[model samples]
Target: MQSPTKPLAYSYIRMSTDIQLKGDSLRRQQQSSKAYADQNGLELAEAFKLEDIGVSAFKGANVSSGALGQFLALIKAGEIARGSYLLVESLDRISRQQVLDSIPVFFDIIKSGINVVTLADKHLYRAGETNFADIMYSVMVLGRAYEESKTKSMRVGAAWENKRKNAGTRKLTKVCPAWLSLQENRTGFDLIPERAEVVRQIFQLADTGNGSFSIARRLNQTAIPTFTKSNGWHESYVTKILNSRAVLGEFQPHRYDDHGDRVPYGEPVADYFPKIIEDDQFHRVQASRRRRLVEGAGRKGPEYRNLFTKIAKCEYCGAPMRFVHKGRPPKGSQALKCTNAVRGLGCESISWRYSDFETSFLYFVKEIDLTATLKAAAERSERATVEQQITVIEEKIRQLTAKRERIFELLTEPGSSTAFIKGKLDECEAAIATEGAQITKLREQRSMADMLPTISADELRSLIASVQDMSAPDIFERRAAVANRLSILVTSLRIAADGRRPKMKGIRTFLESQELNPDERDRLIDHIEKTNKQSQRYNRSFNVMLADGVSRYVVVKSDDPTDIIAEVLVDRDGAISGSDRGMPIGWSDGWDNVFDEPVSV
Candidate 1:
């Protein structure tokens, strides 16, 4: 009645890369599958090892390549063993799609008078016993997971665009020429008080007849270095700084986004960060360009232009005021000011100092009436939003009505043919059908709206402020501020010395007015910290791969990779050295004392 069942079987193994074999990835796994066979009194025979196969799972992980196909082919022909058993080290190691297609294969294997054994999952098959509901549930879960992944991808893309569009004013809090981060929200910048002093000295130098070249030479004589640490400063670099809006006292947002796009610039941060010189010092540089024989042909300003460039309109002309630099001011000094002042567009090139702008900026950044503006914006948003929905419904009705009228006109046209009239009527009929459905949807929306109660002022303000200042936060904070009600306005940039406030526009003015709740901020910080840490590991791993000075190949490390194998190809000049936090916080003591081993790159 039982001739020991002869227990026919085969071994299966896979390794993602050639190097994985050397790491004994397959070798290390075979032993476990073998052990499962030995314990079950089954004999392992032939082996099928698939290497360098490119199909990715990351979903259902309990599949064996060729096993099902071969088994099905054999079973249909009545060729496979009557009581054979299949052996593997568990499912996930074999495939990514664990539950979906695997269970059916398991059913097939059992149908062929076979049972299954797994090493890690400890799965053992008893003939005729299968879990259909569980498998169906798994399918549903996987389906839901896939849907979620798609939704999250779309949401992430949309959020990034939103941040880029609204963050046009983020840079005012960003790193300054002297490395300062002026916003109360930001934690660090390259700014040094001493370096800032040196920049001030540069403006002062240019204010005198010492041209940019002369100023650069004078600067090189001192201990300070340009951003790149060159010995002699260049006129090009000097000109850039004098013309930069940071010196004119404004923070710009949306310098860059997760995906590449030159984000729309932001409004000047209300007087928060300091300016290195007066607006006139910048203007002199501009005038110098115009008065020169070349009409500012070779002149190039700093790359970090403030986001407020076009937002501030010339109040007199009601056109966007342009920032301009002049080399010769009324006082024979360099200055920064609006370009339109003289073009009969507004006023003449008024010379100014980075210092004066910086001082005035401090006041502006500090003085936005956050509460009043936010409340007003909240009201406007509610009104506009509801009205916008109303307009969509009305617009559709009008379109359908227009088509209906056109059909009537076609039927009545003096020489119209019957076929022509019929065609028009058919089109009109189809449009009317679509409009009926749309009208039903709109009625449902309106009914839902009618059922809802209006929010109180405090509640409405809270809702609006929650999404207020979304653009300026860095990668970490920004990711967590996922639910943004962000808005920005770049309406008025430069103001008189005694100007008391920064006029708000868009959503920013509203958020600035509302009182900030620390709890929400902390939640955002936590999410940012977690995600940034993981993303940083990938980035640094990519960098370490660069250090290898080799080609890119798939690599798998066993004992916690010292670094990612792909980063070996990059260099210091490569932008995006890594995630913002390239180096681990506790991995090294400091830049001064770390890496004393004289490592060669």
Candidate 2:
């Protein structure tokens, strides 16, 4: 009862670099903290083993988004006892920031009722103690630490800049892409054949419209060993490989900013690495990825049942039409239904038989000269526009390059501040890099314009003939390939049912305003219900638009399979010539007349 309990103490440890963790920095700090706690008769708490390994104090990263930040937040919230002691190796261990910025942080800890004990100096900064000498001593230590870090940063940056400047003469570092190995002399890199082949295969699969996940799964299923220390391939790694411009034999230099974030430092140097994927093929794969993103078809089933993946939409509500199966295999058929109607969101719930729609589409699509249509759709003016943009970006790059050269010239002048000139050079280089990136994008767009559907009209006709039988084993795969080709040709397929939405909103609002009796309200609701049910049992139609702005309307009657009507809408040139049969009277006026008689929904 006479012996008093020791006050609680927690240790805070941090290291600027991970290399120090491999050394004795961690053990040295831990031992010093434990020894200090023991000699001071304090209970060293094992619950909060705060550490910020490899975090930089120079940029205050350890205090923001690190373990130290979490500890400070807890202290402010009164979770930690007021008189608890915080043991660190030294003042610099807490922060290496400038004295002005770091002093406030040191005082913040002391003011919050925590004692900061520096093990290296054997000094205890007690809570509520405001010694001017102690404050000045801490400031001096922080200032010295900041100067050390700043000097180190400058030296490292200069070394890297030198390496980048001579990248063509020698390899920058031992670290190369997974598919390459740095030579023994460290002068160049050589590609590994097997890994390079795998890289090529990945790009080929992506260009064929396979997503990264699918490619990764395929590789894993085939038991292909990954480049890294992993059991199998991952979608993230596959995406990284696809996105890397390093495969094009170019290298972009980077540098860390004040915030410790890496940013592009200079213009990309071409032929820095061995070219793996061809430029045209790489740009084509990028275009395919962009199309997949816009179409929202990043993931798909192996079957790829629906040709109209993201192209199909409800004409009434503008919601996507989902492909679904109805019933079991022999008796079951695939159908497309409006997404909004399926969710019971006030849209007509008419179902379209996918088999019949596909058949009609294949037959009618043959009437149009696809080759001619595709050629017309490929606008030469668009390529000219991209060329113009590239010219403008090239001009900007020239100006920035000239400015950077002038800055280098000024560095040779007498009494010029080297740091100021270096800063100006960095800004100019960053601007040149940005402009170069814009030029690269414009060139990619130009390449994308050259990418047209690879399938010819005869090949398409033959494919259509081969898949005439719906029950064929490879029918799904064949149709999927056809769908991929059609995705490049067709822009949209808008489906409209024969039914019209009921206009009962005004009546309901008027009834609510009148404070009608329950009986009257029930009677009005019953009338609206009957009207909605009657309107739902009508035919479904689809409006398909080509890339060249040509459209075809197909009306499918559920009650009469033989009553299917396929008619081409008037083209932008006011010419209608897809079907051998002429357009019906009053149809030439437009879609308004086709659904003019609105049925109750």
Candidate 3:
């Protein structure tokens, strides 16, 4: 009788630490697996080594993006031949995850018709042939591995706590302040002469009445290298150096929040290292900063200077129109003047007085005809619906393309009959052609849906009423409120000195920018939500991450029941066309009319 052909084999290896990878651990695992495969009449497949270095098996790393996941993906894609052998050093190497999680993953590999060979235990596990004893043994081994990992985690946590408590007394950690050097014994800090001198110079400049900007410019002129990797000095960097307590020989521990803002963790250790700046000089710098804050220098105002700073540009020189407060105290007038004009440049654009601009802009904002905006929004809504249909057709086209490629591949195989190959190829090509035509038709419909559509008179009036009172007593508050409204409803405003008042260009630009086309599902997911939960179907306000990378809040009424979505409020006003929504209805771009229920048209 002919001997059974040697089963194809693949090896998997993993190490959870740099030390294990650097040592002979990986080598030993490979050697053992190879020996087992040789002895068991299994041929190790070509270029089949899988290694996940410094990845914790106990953390379900294998089930995610690791080598194990790639192995499973290959099996599902039919890249790996059925009835192959998967060789590993042991069960723990496969995964140290809990039995509940790891057992299922093991079963998945086995069910793919691959036999698992654990070299350490000399046990071979086949998918369909597993008995009660085999399962119990696997679970026992996985449980031990999990418990081992848990024990190690607790020990590491305890060690870290002890280190943190004794931090100040010990030498400085791996990374030290640029102005200080780690001690020879690797504990505490020692001043670096060169960097410490730069710290002293920064304090000296601040003490001599030089502002952060002036100091930064002077340092840059002298070619002074900044702290860390930055090549040159900046005003912000100068300010940070002046504010740091490290110059005064203090050690402060800080932790970062989810948003990456720094938060102090514990009380600072005073005199932790040799001082670079005197306590007297440090106190004087602090006083200077406080005095500057009181004098309106580099200080956050009670409000923003104007509603439009970078938004309003000079019609002549194109310089930004900045808000300036002039005259004495209460009589000071707020105006938007071109920066180039103020800086002695020959910008011919006339400065607009804030009061006059506000009066004219408000009047124009009140008179905004939402007719065009409403039509544009309706068109966008229609486009979004058609885009979703296009997405389905595109997916079908992808499948058909793959099928056609597979037919071509099969035709190249030896002994394939010409008649049979031609018949299969013709079938695949026909299906591909049909799907391609469908995609073309869907795209054409999407292009037509892109045309503007109008909203009803009642909806237009409702949108107009929302911005009628865009005024506040505080200049900063007024600008903020007005800017928010104008950014959504008004695209541009210009007040020409030739006698024309400030006029709004309309909300068409704003609406068109916020439009969505759901032709590609991957791209659409960024803007569209399929489920009610993802759509924030509740009264509570929630934020959505738009395709443009802007996170806009969908404000809902607070009093409504959380179970149902009453109305979707967007921008300053929650008009249907005011914000874009994905499809459930026909392709029409414009503000969606609310009739007890949102029905797509």
Candidate 4:
């Protein structure tokens, strides 16, 4: 006859702190469970590995969101076989919750046809067997565990509270930012010069419109070692440094809640660390980041080619116009093509050479009076108006927060409906989120206003002149800097192409009116036909809208790449001016139609 198979037993192990793992906690528990299983003729269920590390059971967190909760759920669903053993080191491993609350969980397991074995005390609560002695023993053990955890939690909380009270005078812990180290006296922090300089360089790069990834790449290329143990710099760490207020010599105290999550507990203390960045520069970097968040952070590459990155759009299908390079110089050239056309989305595939557009735009933009443009923008978005709007939204958020607090108080009242209270809380939270988003948008607007370039008219003109110099060694860098400035000055650039061919009848009439022989007329006719064909290939226009509500309509007539012609039409305060001397006959008509339609910025 075959030997009888042994019963299966699943072991559960838990530790409130991972520090216990460094000692005999894990190994000791494993050995005890193995010994018990071997001695009782039970097979250890290695398949069911249940362990909760760094998980607290004082408030039943282990049973609520940990592996133990999953195991109990499996037992309740009748997945685990009847008469299986759940072996634990002690009752506290299951729960340290108050006896009134923990008794139900303790009894639920036994009632579900599983045996509970406490390896430490060698007690077994078998399935379908209830005894007064077992009940009393479990209650006493659970009660004692709850009291001990409660006392320890209170003591730790009190210690943290005291530390927070003295945070301004002394350092709270040895831990500090990577750029600084706690002093030996334990009263302050000292900055490491090399690391702090790197922090400053990060802020300076950000202020000039470099995003986190760009800054990290630049640092790595220069072989700048990171403050951490990592081999090289990373974008995430760069972003953390950019967003931390610790560089401004401030610290915010935090405390752990009952759920074991850290939350800010008090107002931030000032002058906690050595200041590495000034206030104006810090705010400027923040403003640049916010602007990049809205108007995308443009791509970084060897050549910062696209000046009109997120601002340029195709007038026909409202798709972005991307700058694309076909091949090497002898075979192909860089051009701007509508993304829709490239995707075969029902738009004409007209490629406008970027050289022609850049030259024409810079030549015309130099004629504009930037001082007047800045004044108009200031009038449109007054600082006072933005601040007033921010105040109103903040008040609305405060009222909603108060209302949510009132609803929370009702949760403790007798016979209160939990679902109703939850619904109210959720509604308040949604409203707060909406208002918070509005405030963020308004704040960004104010930041943009603050970040407007503060340079003299001559300096601005010099910058534009430098941007126009394509042969300069640092031309790409110069163009990128000017692009950032233009992003503030210009709101949008709407591009349109006129690919329709010139009328044959009109060409014939014009030729007949001219005094020429048959051969001459034939040659002229052929020339006109060729010009019209070329025009159909590359005749495009742009409607550039300035922040001051001023608009410039630039038409690039690139029938011949070597000798391209451009015309500018300015519309200032409803008055249209600018030379139409060499423009095509009906070019202004297209401009009028575009101006009449609603344009979303």
Better of 1 and 4 by TM-score: 4
Taken over the whole model, the C-alpha lDDT of each candidate is 0.44, 0.73, 0.60, 0.74
Each prediction's number of clashing residue pairs: 89, 1, 20, 0
Residue 151 alpha-carbon offset, candidate 3, angstroms: 2.9
lDDT of 3: 0.60
Model 3 RMSD in Å is 27.3
The TM-score of predicted model 2 comes to: 0.58
Index of the highest-lDDT prediction: 4
Give the residue spans of candidate 3 off by over 4 A: 1-8, 18-51, 64-81, 99-104, 119-123, 131-140, 172-175, 184-187, 191-221, 226-601
Q: What lDDT score is found at residue 337 in candidate 2?
A: 84
Candidate 3 lDDT tens digits, 501-578 = 111112223333565553543344423223333433322222232222322323232232112233232333332322
lDDT by residue (470-549, candidate 2, tens digit) is 56554544555566668787888787755333234446766778878979897987776565444332355667888887
Residues 1-601 of candidate 1 have per-residue lDDT tens digits of: 8676557666655433244556756765677767767777777765544222332233322133333344556656887566666665654333433345544554566666766656557666544456676445435544554455346545754564455444444432244555464556543233467767777887776544356776787787775666666656788988777656676556544432212234423233434356556654555544443344352232222222222343433322344445454443455433234455546553534333432332222212312233334444444444543434444445545545655665564443223468956776787678767767765765555321222344554554443334333342232122222211111322234332111111212234454456767676556555544443333322211001222232211111223222222121123343222112234222233323321222222
Best by TM-score: 4
The runs of at least 3 residues in candidate 1 whose Cα sits more than 4 Å from the true structure, single-residue gaps closed, are: 1-5, 14-24, 48-52, 58-68, 92-106, 131-601
In candidate 4, what are the lDDT values of residues 404-447, reduced to their tens digit? 77678656433456997798789889999999999999988864
Worst 10 contiguous positions by lDDT, candidate 3: 498-507
The TM-scores, one per candidate, come to: 0.22, 0.58, 0.39, 0.62
Compute the lDDT for candidate 4: 0.74
